[model samples]
Target: MSKDQVLDPGAIAARLADLPAWKEADGWIVRTYRTHSWKGTLMVINTVGHLAEAAWHHPDLTASYAWVEVRLTTHSAKGLTEKDFALARKIEEVVGWQPGLEGGALEGTPSDPRFAYIKHGR
Candidate 1:
């Protein structure tokens, strides 16, 4: 696939099929990850930054106490390209990552495993 070539509708749809958590909006593919705490939100943002830097494909990120939205598009190519999907896949791999292997998920407690996968309740 050409790195700079913007994908057509059929191609974009086919690629997007694999990314169930993502949707195209306003000429961009986007996904929002929901977390249980501020720590989780921050962790997601940092992880996205690492992925973007590693892939050399940056994305627009909006982060809050319980949510982080990642928007991907290739500005240089002026549209969506293979690079966007590639980076999105990489980002998805660890976006909802629970960092227990790094010794506690969020620096709160190893006992509670920090704030990951917390269920919502009224």
Candidate 2:
């Protein structure tokens, strides 16, 4: 099917299998990223904003002191589409990256609670 076409429940489920943190709900694909503080929340929001803008597909965001929920759908298509899934993957990658785990020169946020940022899943 075309990328812009609305995905059926079966297709959505298959796609979601590749995105463990995301789910289909109320015609949208959603995911919530937990952070350590307001600062981390803002960072998550900004990161998503940049990704959405770059992809030219935006998502609705709900932010709290320590979390940000992203809801994405193809407004024009009136349902979930490839655009939503692609953007979701990009957002997931950037937001969940742990440079420290890669043993790269760039150390991720310090392990100390005071310096912690995103609460990455183990």
Candidate number with greatest lDDT: 2
C-alpha RMSD between model 1 and the true structure: 4.7
lDDT per residue (tens digit) for residues 1-122 in model 2: 78899988888999999999998899999999999999999999999999999999999999999999999999999999999999999998999999988996998877899988898882
TM-score of each: 0.81, 0.97
lDDT of each: 0.80, 0.93
How many angstroms is residue 62 displaced in model 1 relative to the true structure, after the best TM-score fit? Answer: 0.8
Q: Write the per-residue lDDT of candidate 1 for residues 1-122, one digit (tens) a residue.
A: 78989999899899999998889988899988887788877877888999899888999999878888999999998899999999988887666444554565365223454635422220
For all candidates, the clash counts are 0, 0
Backbone clashes counted, model 2: 0
Task: For candidate 2, list the clashing residue pairs, or say none.
Answer: none
